[model samples]
Target: MAEITDDQINTALARGEAVRLAEPRAASVRYDRQLDRVIVDLTNGCTFAFPPRLAQGLEMATADELAQVQMLGTGSGLHWKALDVDLSVPGLLAGLLGTASQMARRAGRITSSAKAAAARANGTKGGRPRRSA
Candidate 1:
C-alpha cells in the first residue's frame, strides 16, 4: 500500500474545492409529486428541478419511491434509502445523470438536445442539398 502524505491530502482537498466544492451545496432535495420532479435548493440561493425518469437508476422508480429522497453529507449528495441509490449534487448540476458510460450513451441518443438543435438548424437552411447526377 502507498503511504499517505499530508501534502497529498491537502492537494486533493484543494482540487476538490476548485471542482465540485466551488459550487454551493444543496440545502435540500424533495420529490414534488404534482410536477413529477425532484427539486433541489442550493446554499447559493438557486433551485433546480429534474424529472426522475431522466435519471439513469431512477427511471423505473415510483413517485412514492422517489419521495424517499434524503440529503447526504451536508447536502453533497441525494440518497434513496429504499432503492439504495445515491447521486451527487455537483455531478447532477454538471449534467452527469449516471455512470460515465451511461452518460455517454445518453449523449449519443437521437433525442439528445444537441442533435435536435442541429436538426432544427438544418431545417432552417433547407435541409440536405440535392445530389448531382
Candidate 2:
C-alpha cells in the first residue's frame, strides 16, 4: 500500500475525515515529546513515529503538556484528554501534525489478558498461586 503522505493527511483534516493509518491490529500508542514525535507501537512489534505537527487543526497543548499526555484510540483515531487533541491515525502517518505515538502499551495489555485467559484454561489463575486440592 502507498504510504500516506503529509499532503493527503492535511487534506483529510481539511475535509474533516477520520483516517486509519496503523495496521488494523495496532495495540498501543505513545508520544515522545522530547523528540517531538509520536511512536506507533504495534502488537507485532512494528513501530512508526511521526511528528506532532501533523495534527493540523486539532488543538494541542504546549510541549510541556504534551509530555504528560496519555492517548487512547479506537485504531482509527486518537484522543488526548490532557491536551484536548483528537486525530485520526491515517492523518498522522500521512504527515499532518498535532498527533503522534501509538505505542505497544495498549497492545501489551491485550496480550496480558490473553495470557491470563490461557492460564485460566489450564486451571491456573494468572499471576496468582494455585490452591492445592
Candidate 3:
C-alpha cells in the first residue's frame, strides 16, 4: 500500500468539510421498535426515518440487531457491528436503500396506468431501439 502524504490528507479534509457544509449530519440514530423504523436525528434538527426492510443488508434484521445502530464517519454513515452492515447516510437520504440491481428490480416491479401507457407507447415506437455494434 502507498504511504499517506500531508497533501493527500489536507485534500481529503477539505472535501469532507465541503460535504459537511452541504449535507445533513446525523447527531443520533436509533431503532424505534414501535415504529419499526430506524430514526436519525440530524444536526440541523431534522429527523429522518426508514423501514429496515428497505435497506439492503437490514431487510432480515431483528429488533435486537436493528437496535444496535451506531453513527460512523462523522455521522455520514451508519454501522451495525453485529450485522456487519454499513450504510451511507447521504445515500439513505437520497433514497438509495439498496444496491443498484436491487433498486432496478424494485423499480421494474412497480405498476401503474402511466407506466403501462408509457410501455405501450414505447412498444409502438419499435419497443426499444437496438444498440449499435
Candidate 4:
C-alpha cells in the first residue's frame, strides 16, 4: 500500500475543510438521551435530528456510547469514537443510513407483521407465478 505523508494528510484536511465551508455544515452535534435521537446544529441555523437506531453501526449502541458524538474534520461528518463509526453529515441529511448495500437490506426488510401475513396469504395463492419461458 502507498504510504501517506504528513503533508498529504494536511492537504487533504484543508480540502475537506474547504468543501465544508462551501456548503452548510454542522456546528455541533448532540445526542438527546431523552428522545433517543442524534441532533445536529448546522451553520445555516437549522437543526437536524434522527433516531440513532435508524442508522447503521449505531442501532445497538448504548446511550453513553452514542452520547460521545463529535463533529469530524470541520463538521463535514459525524464520528462516534466508541462505536468506531463515521458518517457524512450530507449523506445522513440526504437519508443515507449506511452503505448502499446496507440501505438496500434495510429497505427490503419485512419486519412488519402485516407484511408477513400478506406474504403468507400470497403464498397460499401460490405466491408469484413464474414467468413464461
Task: Give the top-scoring candidate (lDDT).
Answer: 3
**lDDT for each residue of candidate 4 in 13-128, tens digit (9 for 90 to 100):** 99977886777789999999999999999998999999998899999999999999999977889999888999999898899989998989888874898989988998999997
Instruction: Please report how far candidate 4 places residue 7 from its true position, in Å.
Output: 17
Q: Model 3, range 60-81, lDDT digits (tens) per residue? A: 9999999999999789999999
Give each model's whole-structure lDDT: 0.88, 0.59, 0.94, 0.91
**Two-way lDDT contest, 2 vs 4, winner:** 4
Candidate 1 lDDT, 46-111, residue by residue in tens: 998998887888989998899999999878899999988899898899888889888788767748
Worst 10 residues of 3 by lDDT: 102-111
The C-alpha stretches of model 4 lying farther than 4 A from their native spots are: 1-18, 110-121
| Whole-model alpha-carbon lDDT for candidate 1 | 0.88
Ordering by lDDT:
3, 4, 1, 2
lDDT score at residue 48, model 3, on the 0-100 scale = 97
Name the runs in model 3 displaced over 4 angstroms.
Answer: 1-9, 111-133
lDDT, candidate 3, equals 0.94
* C-alpha TM-scores of all predictions: 0.68, 0.42, 0.74, 0.77
**Model 2 spans > 4 angstroms off:** 1-25, 57-60, 96-133
